[model samples]
Target: MSLDVVVEHSVSLGRLWSEDGLDIMIAPTSVVVADALITWNVNLQWVCDLDYVPDQERPLDLVAFAAPCLWRRRMIAALVAAGREHRVALSSHSVTALQAAIENGLGIGLLPPESVRTGSMRVLKTSAGVPEPLTVQYGLYAHDRRTPVVDAAIDVLLKDIPATPGP
Candidate 1:
């Protein structure tokens, strides 16, 4: 239940993260550790402060989440390979606290497509209009095909959150 940054980015070991080489990995996901799997058409809004605006009138900041799992770890590795890791901070803080911080101008946050809200935050345009998205293509894999919990978890994920397009 942690992030696996730099895992299998340079080369694939096809083993558990607990194995000799993969130990350095095993990072968990959050707004602090890794890049999120955004849509290819993701329109990132710059989460900033509304200092001059009234508190009661200020808009809510966007927030999103991703559970820690094997497929997610591979995604982090892919991000590292593409040189897009750490685009924003991901931490263990509560979502409300994180969103408030962003609303207070801590910095921009990359939210999932469904969480996007363009009220107060202004969109950031890449050189090509849309910024590149974090990789989200892998599923679960283990040192041995007979691994128990991993496959079951993967099965659950397969049914829970199917990867979708950005808003």
Candidate 2:
């Protein structure tokens, strides 16, 4: 009986948090009982320091969207095809999760450049090419996509674009 709580894409939530300084809770995975007001993601990339593990081989894999990924898989696949080992073992539960994985030596994960709050993560420099960034979109979602609450929430969510560290 309440429409005050709206479900929105993580991108929108990230942007909203950046702009309004509010905290955010990630959307639930493995459930699609409702539709979204929007269905897009915000694009981003993962960069790693070349010297972190000079002799270590990078694994070309993808982290979960729940991980720090905004949209990192596309580039990761290409890297794999090119014989570069880089990517994560699994999608992370959150950006925090992705950062933890990196800190724990799991692998680099994708995230907005600006979102990198500490020296714990750094932008990567490919030996012979520019970094490949991914595009993600944000959506205002609801259990019933046709509801006015969903519509208004979508508008509110789309009002601002999020920021990143940069490619």
Candidate 3:
């Protein structure tokens, strides 16, 4: 048996299903769930820098995903609801770039747990008056009718879920 994996932003992953080009996708529920079947989800932790303070005299600066990324939109909405303001100092579609920017102290960012560096950043908590970031509900999705290849792929991915980072 052979397996093919495609790494893409969530917006592009949503399009793969309609073209019949994808057998399975592991993505956030907000991105691709409407037509999927046999879905399983895990709650991932959303993390940010420990030293970054919110609601300072000035708007918080952010290093974030680009306009097409759902994380950016979600983070902005959550901050707004909490009566906090922010500016996007840097934006990119690449997770690696976001990590680098956050590490260099360009601005705070909402990052997947795995992308966070232990010494450089920490998970955001309520102490700073920052609203909790959106829940990271990522789902494993498959089409209604599964082929053997698709089934095997799902089995492998299910077995390979990464351990969440520790605080």
lDDT scores in order: 0.37, 0.48, 0.71
Tens-digit lDDT string for candidate 2 (14-96): 55444543322223221222333335445565644333442344344444455233354455665666666554576744666
The positional error of residue 135 in candidate 3, measured at the CA in angstroms, is 0.4
Q: Which wins on TM-score, candidate 2 or candidate 3?
A: 3
TM-score, one value per model: 0.36, 0.51, 0.80
Best by TM-score: 3
Residue-by-residue lDDT tens digits, candidate 1, 55-127: 2233222222233433334434443564443333343234455456556565444444454344544434333
Stretches > 4 Å off in candidate 2 = 1-41, 49-51, 54-72, 86-91, 128-131, 137-145, 162-167
Worst 10 residues of 2 by lDDT: 23-32
Q: Which lDDT value does model 1 have at 42?
A: 27
Q: In model 1, which residue pairs have backbone atoms overlapping below 3 Å? A: 2-27, 2-28, 3-27, 3-28, 31-89, 31-90, 32-89, 32-90, 32-91
CA error at residue 105 for candidate 3, angstroms = 1.0
The candidates, ranked best first by lDDT, are 3, 2, 1
